[model samples]
Target: MSSPQRSMIAKVDSALTRCLCVLIVWLISASIWLLGLLSLSDLTMRIFAYGEGWSDVSWAELSFMVIFAVLLWRHTYYCRYFAIGIWKGMGRLLAFQGTLACMGLVIAVFTVDVEQHLGASVGLLETGADPALELGELGFILLALYLAAPTSVAKRLSHSPVSNVESAHTTAEKEFTV
Candidate 1:
């Protein structure tokens, strides 16, 4: 038999070629657009109002919704051509997205003249002259950023290819042939 070093399984994971990353982002985006966003928003509202409670629904409907959500997210990555910037640390994407979300929340609170009571979100943002923003807005902003992070990473990976040597097996396990 050919050495395990030469086995197809060795490269199967790496063979992903960065496209899978793109695929994941698209999947998430689509999920949010079709099913996740609405369902998640509803879920958030419900939880805030009533906390965790059991829901009785047909299995078929649940299954259909899940499948539809997945498919929608998968397809969305293809819809938009996003230019992801330099590839940095693993968690950088999430961090950047989150920062943007926070900034957006601050901007919204300042621009829109509205009265909102701060329950838990007060700790995160100090209120003096800055109009207080609600927790719901913060939650939605977070959700949006969360969805966009993966796609951003994928765009970066695809645009900037890693050197073959850098990608070569660096796993702990070593192999030997007889």
Candidate 2:
């Protein structure tokens, strides 16, 4: 293939990869949020004996989710596609959020049943609210961060000085060629 053809192909491939990564991350986060909401509802019903107990998730299920997150955390090769390969700084943020999510999941699983107790225990900390709820919330927040990190990095880099310079240079080169 000619140089331009090769570049076009590479750009297409990168775009496809970015789309795949975005879809995967978004879907996973959405699923987790849905499942967590369902699980919370089930637990509430089981404890309070009210409402529909749908989507009750067990400890094993949470463990599986943690495992999946850990695996996803390990596989960050697709991050390069974000912002036309300028999101290298986001790798650490992604890794940290993934780790935080995993930790929150484990804590949530351990205190799944006695969330009130967990809250009481941490009440002295004055952190506000139940510890279990906080942990669960943190997990979801981290997942959101993980989901948004790539796009945020891409956006930030797109307006970066380096990118502006590169864009200007490319435009000049094209004009000269024409």
Candidate 3:
């Protein structure tokens, strides 16, 4: 390829790589928010099923709503191109919370009798409970965490102001000395 053509191709390739990386991260964060929604639903259901005179929604629903709302707001604010500075720590925290939520869901699935509450004669086995929802939730959780954690590409993107400043200082000194 000609030099101009090669340069264009390289630029396109880098742009595509950056876009793909960002999309992957955004999807992970969105999945975490979705799982939080599902968890809220389950908690609400449990409360209504067991609580006496529970005509109104309980604190669990409200809390979950607040949590998800805050998450959405944060995701919207931080997922933008200009907001990449805080992504490293934010991604880790989000991944940790998502993993914990998934574990809690697993424990709930195994411990809580879905059949007893819903009158659906479905156990974990036998003409059993449809595990799709649980499986999908787990899949989302795991995949999201995997994407959020630092990989080689992510490490390459990390920026350090101290290192940058030191390098700039050395360059300035060299220019002044010359």
Best-fitting candidate, measured by TM-score?
3
List model 2 lDDT by residue over 1-178, tens digit each.
6654468888899999999999999887665555544543443343333333434545544554575466445335445544434344344444455555556667766665466655545333354545465345535544544453444343432477876666666666978877
Higher-TM-score candidate among 1 and 3? 3
Q: Judged by lDDT, which candidate is best? A: 3
lDDT (Cα, tens digit) per residue for candidate 3, span 131-175: 465444434544443444433333346668877866766766968
Decreasing lDDT order of the candidates: 3, 2, 1
In candidate 2, where is summed lDDT lowest over 10 consecutive residues?
43-52
TM-score of 1: 0.25
Q: RMSD of candidate 2 to the true fold?
A: 15.5
Counting only residues 3 or more apart in sequence or on different chains, how many pairs clash (N, Cα, C under 3 Å) in candidate 1? 7
Candidate 2 residues lying further than 4 Å off, grouped into runs, are 1-6, 49-104, 108-178
TM-score of each: 0.25, 0.28, 0.37
Please give the clash total of every predicted structure, in order: 7, 0, 0
- Rank candidates by TM-score, best first: 3, 2, 1
lDDT of each: 0.45, 0.53, 0.57
Any residue pairs clashing in model 3, and if so which?
Answer: none
Query: 16, model 2: CA deviation in Å?
Result: 1.2
